[model samples]
Target: MGLFSKDIKTMDDLFVHTLKDIYYAENQILKALPDMIEKATDGGLKQGLQAHLGETKNHVVRLEQVFKMHGAKAEGVACPAIDGIIEETNEIAGEIDDKKGLDAALIAAGQAVEHYEMTRYGTLIAWARQLGRADCANILEQNLKEEKAADAKLTALAERGINAKAA
Candidate 1:
């Protein structure tokens, strides 16, 4: 069913729909990271992206687990927000030629993605709790922690040199 479909008549339905949204988004990120990795010019940025790529893969697995726990199918619905973020990143990356600038842009893009994930996870955790699924909330919290850490790491890398070098 489409987003805002009348089929979603309850919080549980909303929760599951959001879960599917993130599941699709995570899988898209899995597909997009390699290109971002390729475009990155900084060693630290590349390494960070690679590491997060691995973490993202595990996140997909964790999401599937949550789906099973919630008695929902381990499937995904298209997430236009993530798609737009990734597309914007690609467009910006294509427009830039300077290596340092590209790296900085990449870091910014990565942080954008992390911020999106943090919001999603934060909501999911709250909904899970409200739905009396502490188990699901706890599991989603792990993903939220990872997303926050990745954002912080990107910020640290940018502050250390990437941003200045870009400037």
Candidate 2:
């Protein structure tokens, strides 16, 4: 038997896998956040991630809704992609000893996560629409907007706050 030979033979399987994918991603982010918070020295960046942590919790709730809307149990796969991102961030954080430098690293890491989420959200929104669940797409759009905003905020912080401080 082939590895992963169980057929994704139904829409339900696709929906559940997607839900699991995002759930794993979000959960990994939640776990990584405290370290980011601890590493950040920029007052604004630290505060920003803190705020996003709350928003991220809401994101989990939103994903749960997507799962429920499809009548599927919310769960997650290992999500090697996000796990690797988190690992990379941790490595960078460990390498940088300066608090402000760490802050910059944290911002960079947060942006990486935001970019990943943006990609997933974009895909999920399109899939939701294709599946004839405009309502699901609409709900997902909220999280997508938030991810984009988080990325934008991180950029602004890097330019206006952290990078300047680092320099």
Candidate 3:
């Protein structure tokens, strides 16, 4: 069912729907990260993307676990927000010819993905708590922490040199 579908008549339904949305998004990121890794010119950026790719795979597994805990099928629904973010990343990356500029754009793109995930996981954790599923909330908190760390890493990388190199 769509986000506005009348079938989601309760908080549980909304929670599950959002869960499916992130599940879909995480899977999509799994598919997209390799290309981003390939496009990255900076060694640090490449290694960082590779590390997050592994974390993202675990994120998918953790999401599946949450689905099982919630008594829902481990499945996904289309997530246009992540799709758009990835598309924008690809478009911007394509436009940049300089290695440093491309690396900078890639870091920005990675941070954008992390920010999106942080928002989703944060909301999911809050909703899980409100739904009285502290178990699920606690599990989701791990993913949220990882997302925040990933963003911070990207910021540090940029501050250290990627941004200046781009200039």
Against the hidden reference, what TM-scores do the models get? 0.98, 0.92, 0.98
Per-candidate RMSD, Å: 0.8, 2.2, 0.8
- Among these predicted structures, which one has the highest lDDT? 1
What TM value does model 3 have?
0.98
Candidate 3 per-residue lDDT over residues 65-145, each given as its tens digit: 999999999999999899999999999989998989999999999999999999999999999999999999998999999
lDDT of all predictions, in order shown? 0.96, 0.84, 0.94
Q: Give the per-residue lDDT digits (tens) of candidate 1, residues 1-167.
A: 78899989999999999999999999999999999999988899999999999999999999999999999998999898999999999999999989899999999999999999999999999999999999999999999999999999999999999999999
Clashing pairs in 3: none
* Deviating ranges (above 4 Å) for candidate 1: none
Candidate 3 residue spans exceeding 4 A from truth? none
Superposed Cα RMSD, model 1: 0.8
Worst 10 residues of 2 by lDDT: 1-10
Candidate 1 vs candidate 2, TM-score winner: 1
